[model samples]
Target: MTHVITYDIGTTGLKTCVFEITNQIQLIGSTTEGYDLKILENGGAEQDPNDWWNAMCLTTRRVLQENHLSPEDIQGISFCAQMQGLVLVDKHGEPIRKAMSYIDYRAKKEQKEGIGNGFKIGGANIVKLSKSLYITGAVSASVKDPVWKYKWVQQNEPENFHKVHKWLDVKEFLISKCTNKFVMTEDSAFATLLYDVRKGKKRFSREICQMFGVKMEHLPEIIRCTDMAGKLTEGAANELSLKEGVPVFGGGGDASLIGVGAGAVGPGSTHIYFGTSGWVSTVVKKRVLDINHMIASIIGANSGHFNYFAELETAGKCLEWVKDHLAMDESNLYLEKNQISEEKAVVYKNLYDYMMDAIAHVPAGSNGVIFTPWLHGNRCPFEDPNARGMFFNIGINSGKSDLIHAVLEGICYHFRWQLEAQEKKVNTSPVIRFVGGGALAPITCQILSNVLNRNIEVVEEPHNVGAVGAAVVTAVGLGLLSKIDDANQLIQVRDRYTPDPETKRTYDKYFPVFQSLYKNNKKAFEVLNSQ
Candidate 1:
């Protein structure tokens, strides 16, 4: 057993968690620090690399300090972070400019335009097309991938393009600051849509890189997720107030780590996660791609497996949107009209909790209020950039509680669709290991159970699951554990939820109509969104 430290840098902020793992898992402590995301009017999203570093240092020191533990007590450090975002850094590991996020779709124009060597899918020749599918398992016509951003920068910001020395994902950039080594884990490399994963050949594709006009030297050295990146440097350790030579492991992306954290590391294991964005992911032994549905398998945190991801672009974020924007104002107005004190109106303050509590009292299907949770289009069951969120079958009787209830149901319906659609390509176990910030809510987990009609196990410390998974990978790398599968034993399931008959009946009625919304609006989505 060893005490491992893991840093999970997510879309909203950075979290540092300390875990003690042996035959059973225990989360000793965790601290989080928030950072701002810059969203431009031109469909750009960016964040400062330094802000992430500052948050990392702050949380790392806080977790260690509050626990009264010395840095030497920790065996290894690892990470999980927002993936697919492109962070370009100089030779010294300093960022050349603000990093672009995965949600940034500003590069869409460049994505469709032809690149050198016929790089992107739409621009690719027959040879390039055949090789990309065979090796990488998928390529996108959307700007979601970094390769497209690389093309975006060349045509839009040539100065930034020329100054780039190396391209790094969020985790790789952090690891470089820690070890002073410019290296990337295979998982992050694969997400760039630039690496080759034709089983047994784990290398970046030179032909693909050349086609996109990417310099081979601009990419960092590839290493296994469980491999040791290096010892933490003195300068880095000083910033975090950690031991100078603690070993750092190459951690994988957030999705893969969340899989391991929820005890879904076995080749056929499956789990569902609800974060800012969410997904249903399963572990597989080989590269599996459902190009028609846009579900792609990326490298798993476990050294030898792949995580089949059915991604949903918006999941828990919809709740946040409603909580802050829709309900907060109403909650305040209600309090004032009732003459409730700020101290007495406690329920009104915690908007998310109030919504969940409200939803718990409402029947499934939200009394015939149906919502489509496609706030940011959708990523699974189908790929569409123009899809929009909608509320249907609502009457004057429908109130805030019904709307909130419908949003939760709508998201579950989406997952139910994912479960059905993905099962055609990969074997998804009937039981799901649920983990994420949203999994803590009984209403959310229960809805998931009812809609998917599967037994669900909720993680004890749901928010820390991502960090636990990264720490588990570090444990395997440090020889504290024999293999990644040991994570199954270390992760504990706190509770289980079974489907409710009455709730399932309501969902059964609405799920079909929910599925049809996209088809009904497909033409409208394209037309209304066309520039």
Candidate 2:
């Protein structure tokens, strides 16, 4: 079987998967390798570029060997990574320092230091914001932007900044290692906030680059997701157990590719991704920018399509935190009683099973409880770094299950908020294609569907959507597929969760309260955080 390979570079690990492309795509094998994400006390998140490369080599070799495939079996390769981070490399393509992850907020001070400011009310020059939005459809006024981090290195690490030959996102950096050509996908450029994503002119905005004192030359050439960037170099090929000249396609950022993988490539169709982070996004026909609400678009999997991204910083992570701290030691309990290995115990005795049993018993509205899922601050519907997670109106009757249910419902409420915004600003479909780690839970999908009052469909192998997208685009590059949308046949809906009228009625009452809670606490969030 002719196969295509895909690499999903995420915040916590790198996943490599292989898919066979005949009349339809079929997953052959997949594996993941983990790496450390250094979350500094001062609100910094960084990852080693070498570690990323190491994980790629490890996962690729393992997946290939397990599948009993040879180097020549794979025809094409593509990649997508968690977007909105900076990876600076020297002239020889050696990383100058650790990469700033998309969630990294170390540039907060840098946002006020000089022209690097990326957030309004954070020392950003007013004229710069107007000019940037006019030319680029985005601006660097947000510290979390890669441009702000680029400027941070310029101000704080001037020596390394001067040595920097180019700045690439996770996707470009990984592809460069294989192709020996430093290039970026259009989607990656849009995430940089320095690109002119204006409907007619899409390129590095010279004006914004000048305004931020970032040399346009430091940016790599932009290419479409299906473009054949270059062939695998001898060193990379040997490391990956692949052919020396295997073609590598320019796969896009995770936001767009995930939609393609979920079989939501058509315009106005939307998907909700819940991973280490979360967002509500849809494919659109035109570029969109609502700077006031911080709602925007990056390049999508399809060339002319725009991906309207309403980002939420903390979704699954909030649940993860709760599971790690609040949930009982199920693995240990099984280990002591059954004498099973820790890994096997974890696999056989699922934590979600435990939580879901209790959560299922709890009624809607979490027994009059509410949760705010801004554990790491927020980026969509509005950008507020000062915002934080909160559980409101708790009483003596509240139990662990109610709290757990509250967290799940809280995340769904936020999705509804973003969906409403998209319905007004961008065309959002009534049904949502749900994919990611959170969607693995049937209870989570049901809660989201009821809260949003829409159908939530889960496709087979939801967690692997990103890989599917990359594989499909690689197939497109290799002429194995007609277009991205042709991937629909390869996807199968595992189940669909419909809104229960009674539960939807309850959520309708609580959703408005959820909206007001954020606004009522907005200034207080800033003031308390400032102190």
Candidate 3:
């Protein structure tokens, strides 16, 4: 057996996991450290790179000590991180400014002037859109995309932009700190929508870069996800209480590897992830694009494959917002009560559990209430930064339980929307793997099953799927496994949920209204939020 450490870097926190990889992937120890994501005025989201490094150091020491293992025992290290973040680093690999979070949309003006204005189709300049699609199978159409972030910095923070030595994603920045090597895995490179996806041309496209006014020099060397980036350096080793020269694999973004952790690497294999953000992805043999719906196939960690992907900017984040605002009383219970036992004496661990327990008996459809889960805006099926979440059709009879249940159902409704959009182009697996922090709740699993009317499979340690996927990449890099496809044999499902026809009927009744909510309120959203 080989021991490895995988860091799953998320928007709000970092999760570190130690795994024993053999024929099966066993999680031995783990830790999570959170950092703040500063939400600036005008849709700017940022995080300090130093905060991430500190969290890594703190979690690394704790997990290693708790597991009674030394750094030398860890055969390799890897990362699966949030994608599309823009981290501009200087010659010394230090960040020139605060890293732009994936949700940052301050590039509205840049997007407008760059691509949103002029002769356009689907809100993008037709000429540029066609070129981008021809080369990359995607377009930098959203204000939140990395190229626009780079442009935002160039026009607004010209001094910082001049000092940038290379552009890196969240995982690439961490990889640089660990190994003193500046590189981006294929998956991260492709997310920029600047890389050429044509056969025998897996490199960054000079034409797309020039069209977008991006300096190719700022981009880092591209490497496959299964390649070794470099060895952990002495400075990083000392900070994390580890040995130097430990191989650091070129890990991928959550989009590419989370599905791998769910054993959804094969073509047509689908998985749904609900975390701070959520997405529906299916492995496909070739690239696919649906410009109308804003869904496209992105390069995955596996060679010659793409992930047909759709995203929801905020998924479990809506739950977080509910816990903060709507569930104030329940939040107090969370602090006052550490654990609660029921007839089964099941110890409730987190506030979500208590919240789920409180709403477990609430019927499907939230009793005629519908909710839109666009708290931070949306991506797939539509691209509207002005869109905001709301609880619709709430009557005087509606209770807190109804609203809370509606939030969960609202997210599931969006998932179904994305799933159907994907199905329009390609077939998806019937037994979809559900993995993420949200999947820990059985109620959520069942609600998702009912809403989508498909079997929902949950693996052990659903929250750590990203970390496990990173470990699988490391194992392949270290030659412990023959290929990534071996993950299907290692990660097994712990539970499978079948849809309840009666519950499905209730959800089916409301799903149409949920779909119409966006179209009905879009004008109102733009009018109110166009600031």
Q: Which candidate is the best by lDDT?
A: 3
What lDDT tens digits, residue by residue, belong to model 1 across residues 409-451? 8888998898887898989988899989889788898899999
Q: What is the model-wide C-alpha lDDT for candidate 1?
A: 0.83
lDDT of 3: 0.92
Q: Least accurate stretch of 10 residues (summed lDDT) in model 2?
A: 114-123
Q: Candidate order by TM-score, highest to lowest?
A: 3, 1, 2
Error of 1 at 433 (Å): 1.1
In candidate 3, how many Å is residue 266 off? 0.7
Q: lDDT per prediction?
A: 0.83, 0.85, 0.92
- Residue-pair clashes per prediction, in order, are 0, 5, 0
TM-score of every candidate relative to the true structure: 0.94, 0.93, 0.97
Q: Clashing residue pairs, candidate 1?
A: none
- TM-score of candidate 1 relative to the true fold: 0.94
lDDT of 2 by residue, 1-531 (tens): 578899999888899999988887788899999999887766678999999999999998899899998898888899978998899998888899999888887778767664443455333566787787688776676668887788788888999898999999998999999998999898888888888876677889887888778898899998989899999999999998899999999998899799999999888889999888899998888778776667777678787888888899888888877787566545575445534457755764576655776588899999999998998778878777778899998999998788899999999999999888877787788889999988988989999999988899999999999989998899889987878888877888999999999999999999999988889999999888642
Please give, for residues 103-180, the per-residue lDDT of candidate 3 as tens digits: 998899999888887799989999999999999899998889999999999999999999999999999999999988
- Residue 524 C-alpha lDDT in model 1: 98
Better of 1 and 3 by TM-score: 3
